[model samples]
Target: MALTLRHGVFMAPFHALEEDPTMCIHRDLELCEWLDRLGFDEAWIGEHHSAGFETIASPELFIAHAAAITQRLRFGTGVVSLPYHNPLMVANRLIQLDHQTRGRVMFGAGPGLLASDAMMLGIDPSTQRDRMLQALDVILRLFRGEVVTETTEWYTLVNARAHLLPYTRPHPEVSVASAVSPSGGRAAGRYDLSMLCVAAADGAAFDALAANWEIACRIAAEHGRSMDPARLRIVAPMHIAETREQARENVRFGFRKYIDYFNNNSPGRFPVPAGTDPVDWFVEKKLGVVGTPDDAIAMIERLQGQQGEFGVFLQQTHDWADWEGTKRSYELYARYVMPHFRGTNAARVASYQWVGENNVEFSGKRQAAVEAMFRKHEAEMARSGGGS
Candidate 1:
């Protein structure tokens, strides 16, 4: 059977550093609630400590808060940088969180993203990969109720065990972050886990996605584990409107923020020669989509064709549009783009056609009843009563 695509938001949530961090967090929670009400399937919160903008330091804490407000939507750590924390603590918190949220939590693991963040934590950036692998090894074992006794340069545990099990059967959905590298794929496959391709919009990763999954399967084969493409989640930033012109115009409001974010913080990632229009350049690179719902649908379809049928399409919700416009864009996606892949509108369309086809029968019976009433009045008039 074909996989029905689910909608979600991959929120690294780049707010300008100048904005109030407190307000930024509030808005993120609001975004979660908004998505929940709009019927989005999941919302993955980003983890960062040193970055001035991507300030949600603990995705687990944020998930707890967001879960309290939202009813049905699931939450992921968006990747808790495995290199930064003790794996046992990470596993324990997530397991307890799974229970707290009534099993709406996911464990997203990754090597720390920022070199500066690693350095600040007294870690060499080069050691992050090894650190992540070791930490994840322990984390997965703990989730499976194993008593781990592992020691590493950064952290150590002696017979550490998780007394509280995850609410999700087996365990919470564990997703590994992937972009242009085979590390994430290999790790996910070796451990039998899900993959979150966070760089689906990036020019580089967009092309490498198939090869990445292929690497995962190869690694899984070596580990005697099976890989499921349906467990993959692709992330792309998009804004939808009724018209392309409106989308282009609306995206301009936060266009500079987008470029400046990459140019300054994510230095050299976006090579816009300091003079040209950043918004035009962004669209020219095809890094993000800003158009009508059809454009959104087409982008998703193309992703599915290129990367295989993924379970989720996560909208990268940078502060590209203002609050109201952001909400409106989500509404457009829910009303139009979502139904296309999910095939939700098929049932509604079928019912409409059924009603149209069956209407003639109803009208014929009603017409006959009216004619019989008229005939009875005509007889009464002939017998001495007059029809009004």
Candidate 2:
């Protein structure tokens, strides 16, 4: 199979113009328009409920509107929080969006972070894994046009069927965002789903991600199944510019905003080990690629070599809230980085062909917690008839 370099948009809620929320929406729309013109393969929106910073709480609604405006660019939820939704309803919405976009929809599902959001909805967050597995089974079955009736500890669906069928046969491509977790890799292998390894500029982190993929591939072989390296994806925060200095300056201020946001939300203050400052680790590790066009392309090539058959190069310019810089970065990456690998085929390895199963018992307790909370909210909504 030929290797395809998939370009995608990472749409974060930009509150640059804090006084006017609509302006942020418009800016995001404009960015989408630019991506379409630039020949990007997909645009991924994230799902975050009640997060004051990013307003795209409902990605399905946003992507539906995006479908109307763009002709070729695909729309996706970098992930829709599965534990928070009824799988049947989400499956219907996904299929509808796929049809609206004319078969250009990719599904990225996850059990969300943020305990406070779950708590507000009265969810225990403890049973999140069970919820994710059950929900995933339902959604996948629905996409496959199966009449599913499943009773799990957390959820029960009795002979539920979807009226809205996805345009893609057997459903559109599905991916899960793995944030440095072995469970993510195992899940991808277990379900035959794509594993999207989230990358920062850090080489060490990238290496660790590659190791996880190796484990996933090995596990798949044990189950008498095989995974193509091309099916693996890497999502990185990247910005490419004319010059390295310009790239640094362009991304610095915007990147700082994201750093502040994460730092503020991080729980517990652990003392740094004598030689390891997080900032230094980030730059040394290259967690977020901020460099000239040539440098960015080189970094991607390096990542591809390590990760194998990397499919998507999701450029996250919006995270910085610098529209002009974001546009420029996209253009630069398109002009320089994409051409080398866009249509190349993912390389195959003999070692990854088949292996014995380790019978890894992965647990998703956090995922369960989010699901329980969301189900409670769904129940309340059903009683009141007030939710979508």
Candidate 3:
């Protein structure tokens, strides 16, 4: 059977610095409602502290509010920066969320993303990944009903156990973030967890897609576990419009701010040479799509070609466009791009073709039936001496 690719948003909640922070955050919540109404499968909210642009600090709190407003859209931590929290607290909160959402919660864990955030917390950037792994181990144990008693340089869990078991059987779908590193793959392989390839849009991470999956599969086999491609999610940035030119224009709203954030704060991650057009560079590098649904389809097809089969395509949500334009982009994606991959219209298309192919025969039968009815009516009229 072909994989049914799920679609969602990975909202770092990137907003322009000039926008009011409160309104920006509310708009993020509204965006969740908009996506849910558009039939998006999920929305993974990010956890970032120091980044002024990617401002949502608590994904859990955001998920709670967003989940209440939306009916069906599942929420994820987009990764709960595991190194930043104690395992016990993380597990408890996740369990509560799982129950609260009625199992519509997914737990995506990762090492903290912003180096500045880590610095403020007194966590060394080098140790974040290791700490994430350590935390994952304890969180898993707690979920499985184990009383964890362990000590690490960063955290100590002394007989730590969650009071409530996860509402999701076998626990809410656990996923780890994978960018360019093999660490996410290793952790997923060992724990038999899902993966969130957060930076699949980046050229370097794109190149590592197959290699990282290979590492996961190899390590899974060694651990006597099997990695499911259906559990793997690839995230990339995209903005769609009615036309390529229109999309390019739409992103002009705040694309510069996004570029500035990366170039100034996190340089080299998303490099745009001084003179080159940002959108052109972005598309040329195969970093993402900023065009029509056709372009989005091509980007996804490219990813499918690279990684074979994966479960989800998470659009990295950004303020590249205005509110209405952003909403329209998602609506267009739902109307066109999603169905292409999902085969949502395959049966409908087949039915349409079958009807069209038999149109002559069906039309002939309808004419014959109408003629027969007229003839019967004339015979009855003649018998009654009322025929003309």
Candidate 4:
């Protein structure tokens, strides 16, 4: 059976240091509007305070702004670093966004991604995961209308309850970020939340994808909660054009700066050996697609073969290409790649085949009808001449 899949961008909006930050943000908003026009299902905006490149400080604020300009594209806080904010505030902010967007919001929780982000807040890196779990528990309880009063080493929640219930039933859809570690899977299972495989492009992460999902399913079973594959999202990087060469050429505009950001600033280092052509290295490693729509389709099929089925495939947004080229890349994906996976063209394909298969018989009948009309005209002319 063909599966219904949703497509979107995971915009940890990577901009070069040379670019103006103000213009970069506006372009990011424009990208969301572009996506909405192209019929994208959603956009997951990142929240980062430190990494300069991934510049959105507040995903919720960005979502509010983006949502107002667009009509139907849903938004997720690619993740709100749960350990960074108070649980009450996190729950309240999302609930308000839920109502504000009329339920076009999703709550994606994670242990903070950047060590520098944690360091700035005086949070111990080692305790971040545990803190995320604890904070999430409180948030979920509050969402359920439970007045939660809990004390923990990091913080204490006293008689806390959300004044406004979520516009979404039960609550806005909740998801947790999963990379190489099992912590995300464990948390997702325990809480029955969706899983966002953020590092699905990494080799180790790709290898562990199925196992982590199994862990989620096993834990869910133990808790009497079943995990839905429809809620599982796998994210990877991609940039496509009319041809593979053109795609590679497009990335040359800003790929080096993106590579620099990852190799130096990000904790999850991208190991591109010196003297290796970054484009060749990236594609050879199967880290992402820097090719045409066919390449993107193949990559998605490869992922499906490895992990079975999933809900969404979020393109890891990058400044690999120039603005126009970048927009074209997404346009190509929307025009060709999406329909291949979505089976959107199935009916049209079937209709064309049906016409082709019956053309001989239909043509013969059409010719016969024309000949009969000609015969009728000649007979009427003869009868009128005889009467005259």
* lDDT (CA) per prediction: 0.87, 0.72, 0.93, 0.93
User: How far is 80's C-alpha from truth in model 2 (Å)?
Assistant: 0.9
Model 3 Cα lDDT, one tens digit per residue, 301-337: 8999999999999999999999999999999999998
lDDT of 4 by residue, 1-388 (tens): 5468889999988888889999999999999999999999999999899878988999999999999999999999999999999999999999999999999999999998889999999999999999999999999999999999899887888899999999999999999999988999999999999999998978899999999999999999999999999899999999999988999999999887888898777544778887989889889999999999999999998998899999999999999999999999999999998899889999999999999999999999999999999999889989899456
Backbone clash numbers for all candidates listed: 0, 24, 0, 0
Once superposed on the true structure, which residue ranges of model 4 sit more than 4 Å away at CA?
266-268, 386-388
lDDT of 2 by residue, 170-263 (tens): 7988887676657667777878888766543344456687778877888888888888766676777767778867777776656655654555
Clashes of 1: 0
Query: Ten residues in a row with the worst lDDT in model 4?
Result: 262-271
Order by lDDT, highest first: 4, 3, 1, 2
Query: Considering TM-score, which of the candidate structures 2 and 4 is the better prediction for this target?
Result: 4
TM-score of each: 0.93, 0.79, 0.97, 0.97
Q: Candidate 1, residue 232: CA error in Å?
A: 0.6
What lDDT tens digits, residue by residue, belong to model 1 across residues 1-388?
Answer: 8888888998887888778989989999998899999999999989887757787888888999999999999999898999988888899899999999999998889998887788788888888888889999998889889998877778879989999878898999999999998899989888898999998878889998999999999999998887987789999988877888888788777768777767675778888886887767776787877888998888888888889888999999887778888899999999888888889889999998997899899789889999999998889898884644
To one decimal, what is the Cα RMSD in angstroms of model 4 from the true structure? Answer: 1.6
